[model samples]
Target: MTNPAAAALIARSNRLGADPKNTNYAGGNTSAKGVETDPVTGEPVELLWVKGSGGDLGTLTEPGLAVLRLDRMRSLVDVYPGIDREDEMVAAFDYCLHGKGGAAPSIDTAMHGLVDAAHVDHLHPDSGIAIATAADGEALTKEIFGDRVVWVPWRRPGFQLGLDIAEIKHRNPQAIGCILGGHGITAWGDTSEEAEAHSLMIIDTAADYIAENSRAEPFGPALEGYAALPPAERRARAAALAPTIRGIASADRPMVGHYTDSDEVLDFLAHAEHPRLAALGTSCPDHFLRTKVKPLVLDLPPTAPVEESLARLHDLAVAYREDYQAYYDRHATPDSPAIRGKDPLIVLVPGVGMFSFGKDKQTARVAGEFYVNAINVMRGAEGLSSYQPIDETEKFRIEYWALEEAKLQRMPKPKPLATRVALVTGAASGIGRATAQKLAAEGACVVIADLSLEKAQEAAREIGGADVAVGVQVDVSDEAAVQAAVDAAVLAFGGVDLVVNNAGLSLSRSLMETTEQDWDLQHDVMAKGSFLVAKATAKVMIEQQLGGDIVYISSKNAIFAGPNNVAYGAAKADQAHQVRLLAAELGEHGIKVNGVNPDGVVQGSGIFASGWGANRAAVYGVEEEDLGKFYAQRTILRREVLPDHIANAVFVLCGPELTHTTGLHIPVDAGVAAAFLR
Candidate 1:
């Protein structure tokens, strides 16, 4: 418990694990061994402290480090005298624990314990792996690192690999580190600082060598973000590809979160022979454990027709899954359970960058981040020599390792709206923005659509976190823009699970004073816009074959024709009617449609911010600031109907609360008797 050597090792592991480039997620483990007094007998015994299996080193504490009897662990390996350990070796690990303080030792404990040094730091830095995964890796290590490094051939990590490393070290005796071909390197010293610093130094030297020797070639970029592509081509490509990829990735589970790559991805896939090279596998054994042996390489020609693109994407996905299954079948042992996810972690599209997905945005983003680093690794490794990662069989060992599978099992369950996507029109401000925020908070990925693309983007940023929200410029009256917005939502978030038709324009002039032009403007935006959004998004919902909800933001004036509120009221009335019509048509498709009619919400609303409040307040003989109070007092409940109130009502309809209700209108006008729903 008081070993300074073990404490230092734990601190070093945290530092190394904190950087993904140094070691992939939960991939590498470190160790320190020293003599300690037994708690019960006060007898001096040599103990080995190693990182526990399935724990992230970056956040690992002293307790997460396992202490084992050095003699017990070493004795088990000595008796085996074999290249690999069978399943029974797991039992020996428990018997060797110094105390209950240490949990199950990492699968690599035998390998760590075999090293004779007082401290050992094992890492899978991409820079070092860039060299280790090369065809000429063994020679290159000696050439770059000189006699300081010993080269070991790829061995399946277990008791045998531990014995092999020990034998290699005994023979060399002087090398500070050993390079495990197609895997990672291990560095050791008498102290944690020496081992940790030298480990990083070796990695840095390899990176410098690659940078100075390898000349990077320039290649054309791919279609990554929608804003990066031509407007006319953006929606079509995104709509056809995103959902198809989603369908492929979500064969067993929904892909609620997706991540599109950037220009670095384009540069990786731009090589003439990238398709073949990418299939070789990840740059290191650690990355292979996470991203599978290789990414799914696809062909997405920019000029292909929409129908052809869909077919092509679908066919490629099918082939990728089949290929993955074949890989699993070829390497799988009868004792090993099937590898958890058959889906490829990274999908590489030539001239189209890469795509990654997960159950949620953060996970998907993590996948993207790791894959991006993978590209860098491959580039550096290939530049030195041919990129040659560990063989597929070795990959299967790590990928299906019982320890690795346990991590996935430990993941938390999904949230209520997990894997669902929602679109909120006019989301740049007020009620729609509130609704979008609410949906995202409940676990649904949100798409924010507004007339101003800039404002839409601003709103998305303020309510930001990656993959949770995207901004789309949509003038809901324009059929093309409306369709694009819906498709954009589907493209960015996999599919549309809910809709909020909240975009509308006001024309509160009396019918006699209202111009034909004024009437058409209000009708086109409020009535027609709502119809367009619902129609386009409904098609996506139907295609998904998942029941969804659509709610319209109607006005209380729809229920009563108030003074100087003809055009606005008429438009709202038609908009309200569309809710019922949509419910009637889409109910068979399992889409429930509803409406929320609120009186006045002046705070932060564009209706008030854009000067409409001045005229309304003048008519009511009160200042503009008092308009909100006026509406509040007019309601029988005598309460203010805030934007959040409307947002709350819409959320209820979107969730299970109103799953059985449709063709319904909910009034959030506090207590407007005439506006009360029947």
Candidate 2:
């Protein structure tokens, strides 16, 4: 933070990176060259500060900047090997560190350091890439910017590409930047302000040129029946198909999913030329690295029957894997990194939009965004000239490059529930919220479902925002509402791998005091609601074909036969039996159904705050505030039960430790003998 040059470099990077029009997430690098007093020699030494590997520009900090000695970086030119050996130079950047090196140098480090400018930026703007991927890109660049920018033919990013750009800069002294053919753009200036402006100018000029010269209907006009379906129908279909697609995508390894039906994506998919252009795949390295070489597109029209489309999806998934493996076979060399994955990361269903999968939700979402960028690039390229991306062989090389392999190896190991998604009912507060929080901490993307949408969303944000959790409203007693909540989970994070049937209500009443309405309400919300939730989410788990867990939040009252608790006890007892029944039936599908029985969770209990606490206190002959302690006194362990205790029980039942646990109730009631299984 003390270094002025590095601070200014971060500022400039943030400005350029804040807008998607400038660069996609974590897709570009920026640099500033300045003089720093050496600690050992006490002499001014030239230092190059650049954005490091695996860091996003917008969120970059001082530690994310890689500082290298300029003289040592330029020295790599003396022993420069041929293009085939360019990758070796990346390791060499480590030796050129000015200090502790800040962060690991990226492959684009040489490009930033070698250029003779005080500041430099390399970006993957959609407009710039449009011209870069155009068939007539070189001439188009000349026509668009005249002498202000030059064009460099496609070269894999490495030491040699850096030298290529440096030479181009020397020859064209008047040029501020150049379009990297079949790639992106790089701009430079004597100051940070000028450098950022030059980058924007190049991007803006390209966008304007495309706009002026592009012909109408660049995607070759929308096919009549392929247009997007109505909003409600589109979402319903998306919800129906997401699980199957997700299940297929997770075959290689479990993957979290993200769904999008943006106008840009729908428009592109609806066009006549989409089939041909999509087959060619994305041009930029950044695009395909996340999105994969191509998407798995449903060949059927948007209006196809749901069952018919489901059948075709299975066929398409099989074909996609085969095609991907063949692509590897065709271009893979002996030294190529072993095939990473054979599944398509992006799945395109014309009316339903796109579904992208990754190890986590953020990655899946970003992959989808990158594909949108590719769509924009394709639109622009086809508008002016025919879209022409690098050949498949080059894409294969970059996809399996040793440097990329090294980056992947550097990533931290995933958590136990890393790729799993969980849906917790009544998650807006108390035990349900605590359970949702714990599951999310263990790395599961969670759906916080409560009767109140506002409270559910609030809890979700508190848990970790949209990346890790989403909120939806549902009255669990309503079958239709329960299905919609499950659908929301599928649409938000692929399929549901875990379901917590925790939504419930309590009415402490004796046989004479309890009315038909009270009995129906308590049973309706607890026993029947649990059934509805389990049934709805089970469908998704079945579709996933991956083993899952469903835990019910029953009560100690289910067995203790406490006075004036007849209605509540019966509902809880019903839930306990339902767990055993469903576990027996669902075992075939790898879905484990379990229950947690808790002794009067009064503190932080929404049920207690909603009048059940006073009613239970009256039955126990204790003050309302003393109810938790009174319940604890009756237990052998004499420990007050909190929401977190029940939450921990839920986690133990569903977490890695309980892989074989099901068809049982774990008492989290501090050893209540009456509640023990008998």
Candidate 3:
């Protein structure tokens, strides 16, 4: 039986074909299909569809419509091709469809079949065409829509690509559409109109953004790596390297073709101007889970000091491991398993494109995708600044989270810390407010202590939950005030099981011109204040026979001294030391102490607004408007630290999950500490 929508779709395709700009031969095509189910039988009865093939959509018609039995077509593809036959396979596929009283379907029939939606439409809109043409196009898409759209890199279009799309749809049932690298877009919806509207929106938005932004220049020539090597030598090196990669990889390694001739490849090898190349085309979180933050960028020249190069790569790997270990040490539960090993998922030899090694296919695939996305994102963000990921420590905790494991247990509504009480200092804003909110959310009664009484009350009001949180005004540096606040918290919440010392002031001054008064002031606020809070909180926790979590808010400056900020640096340095001392002394009393040293955390607190933000802008002699971009450019992840990021760390440290963790300083600086050494 004929479907009205299918007929209209055929007419629309023919009309579109007449428009010159819309009728580009090789650029894109549109397809529409109808879905119907028998009423009592409740099964798909027919698929009447028009699929545009080689002909331009602008000049297409009913003749371009391919009619076929959907069920029969599915059966043909079910037991599809194996490795050996190529031409024979193609001939067989064509013969079966044509001989079965069906016209040739769209080349994208396999992909369309994967969608569960009643109507599916695919097109390479002009706007998408412009975006896909750029080197960092995929990243630009993410920067704009993030997870709202799924992205698939360019793959040789056919069965394999179809399978990939099918898997993606299965994984993400709610995806609006997907953008194909160097291709166009595929959109699906319950109705034809909805799908078309989604496609139009994606393309129009992408095109508008591209038009507003400057066009990207073509990538320069690739640098030299294997291209400089003799042909035989290059093949031998590849063969030799293949086994090592395979041995460590979770699955069979695919042979990587060497770029011994392309000038673009050679240029990329010879220089590090394009760090994105090392990361590009990798899948998301997959690459991150397997390979970690950054892959090693190997320099192949003999004169480049092979030992130094290897050492640098090894150092990068070691740093990743150390950061991971530190994160685990800070947030691991007493019952959590130990971390296994540290091996990067992917490596980039100067001359080679990329080598992804993983414990399994899933890991390798994830690693590859992450690197690819990172590359594209970095490239796109380069125009604005750079794409900075979260810190190594933060990533590690997320990757090896104990709570994530706990989720696997599927225990029902078990409160791990039902009777616990927590005290959060500087709870009026920033990390403190976030921690207080988190603790209350997790069923712990909380005390919000802040210098500003109004802000404290506001914060307490915001963290509204069954677990009550009360505000207390206290100057942490004033010993009497801190003691009183702690005492009040104990009276209100019954006792304290957690203490988050997140209150501190930042005072920036050059060492040469720094006043002793400023140095003392910084020390009093950060170090002395933390000590008083710990001392007061410890009494309540110890008396209650409850081991508690005490977290100090340090800074990236603590590790790498800040420039023109001697007072702030000195105070942070001391704060870190105090954490260690507190951990040691409090251990006997079953108390845990830790520090969260965040780098470049912006927003939330007025620390940056009153301290670094105001001062750094003046120091750089730039307008306040430009400081954010300036700082963003200077960092690796290029992400400004949000208060939630820091607060999340504190939550992990204080939660029942970290019962065994203590005496550690975790850096939430997005690898800024390593940047200093680099």
Candidate 4:
């Protein structure tokens, strides 16, 4: 049988943790107290089982819980000592760990220990933060909870906060919880159920109050279409701007970029007051640690040219960093450490959408989640009266708290490619998409450049997340668009480490039957487009002084052409020649240029979706449906070459395997005697 206290606390933590509305990623914590035997003495002691650092509440486990001696932890608090309470508090939590738990306790462990109830739940719910940060928050909270909830002014979480909570707990034995200004709500009960229920109840009550009082604002850009542009145009716009924003927010670190136009996000941004509303500092103190006090606002006009947008992004990025440095200077103290991040985690782009940047996709999405929660809140807050968050000084205290710094310090080390960025053209689907997925899985940031932004975004979404693998639209043959796409990749991911020149268009007509338009399309994408992307991105690689890989997805038809596939074959041949030429020129600079010739990818490759494969199948006297097997059987190994197989070959070049190999084309077409090089 489980200890009743632990049972309730665990249940509550799991219940609240599962819902984003209740807690952002790892944002809230809970604790339960029960007497436990000290293994050495077999004597009962008041032990607190609390959420540990790096543990998510929704997935709490017994091991994930940090066990500490409550009495020992409370005693660590020195009464009116001249010592720094913040630093001293950390030492106490460390010392009080039961058997050291071999786990770092949650940052709020001290405060949880101070709560008098058998169970305590602290959550940064959307509703709670809304009420906590709204104008006249104290009065509104008092009105909602009456005397059941005590109101505590915002205090940085540490020993001092623990002391305040303990004093409040003792003073108001009948109180169900406390509302911390510019922070979050805390609820307590004799059982885990009561504490968790009331914790949610606090959120519900505030939500009801805000909903009843606030006015509903119509959501709109009132545009004719969802994006007010063609699918291609919309993609080009997002593709062009995403990297610029990523580069600006990077601050010399590899920042994962997420561009989203979710209905909730865009609806909020569509508001006339969206800028002012989002300008409000983070609703809760802990989120300040992830997103900073506020988001960087980018009012990039939708109609502006790509170059102008890039310039604006640069200007704003400079200003934001300068402001951040100034903010740090204002709060610099002998006790304060240097700021870890000099850039805002969130960026708001009205008339478009918003972006979240972090060291990785998970972190960036976490920031995205916080902003979405803020969107949910600002509505209710605005509906009632107004949103009022903490000022700059308070933001400084929480953002720079030693405990917060320690939390980041405890994060796991990044993967080998975590800092490297790659660009894959024609990434909307097929080999390009597969390559992007593989590179991202290996920890490299991927810029998915395709002709269709929507398809690129969809592919990016499928591979990890939108932030980790970004999508851009580029007509590789268009010099301006190709340059913009490269700029986007550089700005978004810092510098380029790899380029998969794979954008291709298959043509089944012979040169005698193919129109000039169709022939040019093939040459433009397969040959000229590859050249433009390679050339533009090469400039970035050369400037960064980082050796990079350029891998081309050339077709076996480059060397073995079918009767009706003259245009595609010739174009592919051109790309192969360019690969060798580029390898010779770039090898001097440590840039490896290689090509892979793949055959028999008719089904999942998506290259045949345009009926090109079916047309070729007719020439072979086979049904379109049998095109895959037909080609597979023709190969020497009698095996189908999968998109994943091609992707693996691309990875070989992207990784260290090709350190000494260049100007080579690895064949993935099983064994084609005509295509095999001596």
Superior by lDDT: candidate 1 or candidate 3: 1
Q: After superposition, how far is residue 310 of candidate 3 from its true place, in Å?
A: 63
Q: TM-scores of the models, in the given order?
A: 0.79, 0.99, 0.39, 0.74
What is the per-residue lDDT of model 1 for residues 283-341, given as tens digits with 9 covering 90 to 100? 56556655667777766555556677667766876788789889889988887776567
**Global lDDT of each model?**
0.78, 0.92, 0.60, 0.78
Report the lDDT tens digits of candidate 3 across residue range 3-78.
6767666555554445432323322445555556655578766564636334446656566656544565556556
Candidate 4 residue-wise lDDT, 1-678, digit = tens:
455677667777888989887888787789999987788999988889888877888988777888889888777665435335466566657778887444677668878887778888888888888787778778887888998888888776666777788899899987888888878888888877788888888888887887777766623234332233443565456655665566566655656655556677766765567667666666676576677777887665556667776677778778888888888999978888776767767887655666787777677767777788877767766666687778888788777877767776777887756756899998888888888888888789899999899998888888865457778888898999998788677545545778999988887887688999988999998899999988887776664445678999998988985689888999999999999999999987778999999986875555688878878888899998888888888889999887888989988877755589899999999888888775
lDDT tens digits, residue span 236-324, model 2: 99999999999989998999999999999899989999999899999899999999989999988889998999999899888888999
Ranking, TM-score, top scorer first:
2, 1, 4, 3
Order of the predicted models by lDDT, top scorer first: 2, 1, 4, 3
Best by lDDT: 2
Q: Please tell me which model should have the higher TM-score, number 3 or number 4.
A: 4
